[model samples]
Target: MKPLDTAILLAGVPLASPVTLLSGCVGFCEDLARMEGFDFSAVGAIFLKGTTLQARQGNRPPRVVETQGGMLNAIGLQNPGARHVVDHILPTIQHLPTRFFANIAGSTVAEYGEVARIFDDSPVDGIEINISCPNVKEGGAAFGSDPKVAAHVVETVKRVTSKPVITKLSPNVTDITRVAQAVIDAGTDAISAINTLMGMAIDLEKRRPVLGNGQGGLSGPAIKPVALLQVWRIHQIAGPRGIPIVGQGGITTARDAMEFMVAGATAIGLGTALFRNPLGAREVLDGMVAWGQRLGVANFHEIRGTLNQP
Candidate 1:
């Protein structure tokens, strides 16, 4: 099938493909561009690293640890801040082939609004409100765990930005659908489900946690099942409302992406897979095309929510 035939729209932005680079992975799309044979146009959209109100030093050493079938990270949303991103990063990446999106995070509702406003005036095609960074102490997952707070964040950011606002939900919540509904009601253009689940590793030798922060967010294939369930649950609520879901976590191959699509994810995000292969998105897209051809599927939309229920 043609590339355009596989295209999907997210929050009114037409992506060349349904594959999106997850936030905090691509680092503003520069690092991936430097890799040999990496192509920006291969995917639908690129979500830059998590950007906060001010520059942060991030957590101490041992922020990332490899786990069975997945990895854990507590990067602490380290970023160059919103203003620096608007002034330096966005301009440099304006010519990329795909749509550009900003991943905004803040410690307070006002901070979220301010960051959203900064990116709204910039050249990004959309804004993803990252209310689910598990490593932080105050803002990230703390607000996401509560439906009211998540709704308030969505509402606050929506009021300040004209750009599409996609809310990233935490998997740690008891009832993800409640949070999803709250954000959708608050004017979120789309929903990105199943951010890294909170977890930790221990150093047997040192008798301490592997991560300096004592805990970190677990990601990679290990969370694929959980991600799928969350996506499906949220889709049951948001799909009828015309709000798309960005299903992510543990997606490394075409089969993984298809599983998410079948589970109701309108878009698939590439995160931990990038660490294994910088050109992972291209491979996943190519694999998806091959799978589409084999399955006689004309477009990705046909595979979305095709899961069989008993």
Candidate 2:
């Protein structure tokens, strides 16, 4: 067992692993199921691709481009909609070794609650409200950037489902910690800190934007500084209260993982790097294990909140 493998208690449910693979684009139908059988042993669980009420084809070509330290993607939020995911993806993953956390998106508050209620009856372990998807026109950025709307969405979904709810917040706000606290007050089981930061790239040669959407969510190592700031802030304010913080955004190595832990993140999520190398997720996990051994820590939990000062 890895050092981070101490049993995790979430709303009275015990989880075997603390590492979760973050994804927003699992293929259609049995594709997710096949991926699960082959990769489930590598991590604690997988957050399947975000699904919408209606299927989306996402953005146009050149939607993705490589940047200085990290890559930028404008893949949009393309998925086969909720009905197809339910009939096709859920069945295959329901029996995997790791639990399934479904990320649902929409253009309105009602849509968030509507889709969450469906997962309540599925074999899902939890629902992660992805309110920070920049490619979408309706729900994502609108809900996440506004503290009142962010809290409202969580409260509304909580009323409809018993599943442990995780609200993924946006980093584009003026005050990230304030937004994090908004959802906490709304009663979320966990707060997934530091979603991709909003950024743009221009093609000087053509006098146009790089992505079809004109702008895209900035992910990877470039945003690590901003992401670290947000995660640390949440740690300072929320850690003592027992709320679990799931850190993401620009984590590429075991040391990066350690920073999140020291910043008081309970768990870490891997996103953009997975596209560059399929082994990205496994490498991070293995690195953390190796780091723990060198540090002479028996259980990784002891490293939590190492930076907080009373």
Candidate 3:
């Protein structure tokens, strides 16, 4: 049997594998590097935590809560600002084997552009615009929820940066495809589908909200079905244009990752799953290789977006 090739050019960026460590799950790649038995060369890319133009204190405590099949997080895109990241933090992780992409967010369109500009001069291989952070009270899901506004944000970033830009879409929207098309038309190189779903939990005893923020983004196995559909929907728009989709949202196992690929994800993102299993990336890659060998396929691209209708 031929060896399975688990590599591809995501948005024209060469990657070692299709398993990309999602933003927020891996804090600036430093934490993951310190973990035992974790191989940097085994993964494709790492999207650093969401960074803004100015430092943010984030929301109050009680930010994360465990639920039935997943967890709710209102971390509010906490980070030490873009300048600090580009100057101090990025230098420390430059020796990591894999590619690093900056996950950028802001309270306004201009702020998004400024942050992108800051990262454009850094060592980051790419930039992912976080227009869909539901935990934040301003500029996160707000910019992503509107097609025109989302396009504006993408265009703004594109104007300032020479690096490839990937627009992360929000699942909270009524029609995600509309936003996907809008960003693609605005010169986005790739798409990251289904950021997170808006959800809330109440302190039944106290009669107040469980998280510090009234609402938070729900992730884990609970949102897999929704994430799959959204990825497929966005793929219909991105696939034809030759734009890659970074499918993420409840991918915890190899099967889940394969399902996302069948649904049209060019590369799979492992987010919430990392919280429970830090070494899940290796397991997922191993499983994918085994499945590929069993199917007699030399590469995963052969099976990507091959789902059939009933």
Candidate 4:
């Protein structure tokens, strides 16, 4: 099947395919774009690395440690800040074939608003509020873990930008639906579920935590089950409200993307898999086409939320 034949829309943004490059993995899209056979048009969207109001040095050494099925990372939202990205990066990449989404994070609600406002005036196709970041004013508690805080961030950013606001929800919560509902009520245009779960590894030889930061977000195949469940749950709540879901976590192949779509994800995000293969997106799109052909699925949307239960 043709790539366009498998196209799906997310929050009014037309994706050539349901596959998208997750934030923090593509390095502003330049990394994969440089790959020999990488095709940006094969994927639906590209989420740039998380950007804060100001530049962050990120955590110390040993920020990433590989695990059995995934890796642990506490990169600390390292970036060149919103202003620099707006001035330098976006201009160079604004002409890419696919939609570009800015992933913005901040320590305070006002800062999140400021970043969103900056990107709003830029050429980005949308804004994804990274509410999973620790709220400094709230004693390092993640904004995504609390419905109120998450809602406030969404409300603040929505007030400043006309672009679609996609709230990236954290998996480290009791009832993911509560947070999803809160953000939707606060005017978020869409939801991206299951940001890496917080976790850590240990160095048996050194007798210390593996990551420089005591804890890091766990991502890759390990979190696929958890992410699938979260996407399904969020869809149960937001899907009825006309809000789309970006299902991501441990997605490495076409089968993985199909599982997410079948569970209710309108779009799938590929992150950790990129580390293993820069051209993973193209392969995923191919797999989806093959799968669609086998199942006689004409449109990719047909498989969404089609989970069978007795």
Per-model clash counts, in order, read: 2, 1, 0, 1
Candidate with better TM-score, 1 vs 2: 1
Q: Sort by TM-score, best first: what order?
A: 4, 3, 1, 2
Q: Which is the better candidate, 1 or 4, if ranked by lDDT?
A: 4
Off by over 4 Å in 2: 1-6, 10-13, 25-39, 133-141, 308-310
- In terms of lDDT, the poorest run of 10 residues in model 2 is 25-34
Ranked by lDDT, top first: 4, 3, 1, 2
| Candidate 3 wrong stretches, greater than 4 Å | 133-141
Which model, 2 or 4, shows the larger lDDT? 4
Predicted candidate 1: what Cα RMSD to the true structure?
Answer: 2.1
* lDDT digits (tens) for residues 89-162 of candidate 3: 99988888899999999888888999999999999999999987432545335788889989999999999999
Can you write out model 1's per-residue Cα lDDT over 1-310, one digit (the tens) per residue? 3432678888898888999989988888876665666677678898999999899889998899999999999999889999999999887878777888899988888889999999999999999988874324453458888898889999999999899989999998899999999999999999998899999899999999999999999999899989988998898988899999999999999989988998888899999998888778888988888888877887888888888986
List lDDT for all candidates, in order. Answer: 0.88, 0.76, 0.90, 0.91
Best by lDDT: 4
What is the C-alpha lDDT profile of model 2 across 108-211, one tens digit per residue? 88888888887777888888888774334443456888888888889988998999988888888888777788888998888887777767788999999898
lDDT per residue for candidate 4 within 1-310, as digits (tens), equals 3332778889988888899999999888776566666677778999999999899999997899999899999998889999999999988888778899999999999999999999999999999988899999999999999999999999999999999999999999999999999999999999998899999899889999988899999999999999999999999988789899999999999999999999999899999998999788889988988998888888888888899995
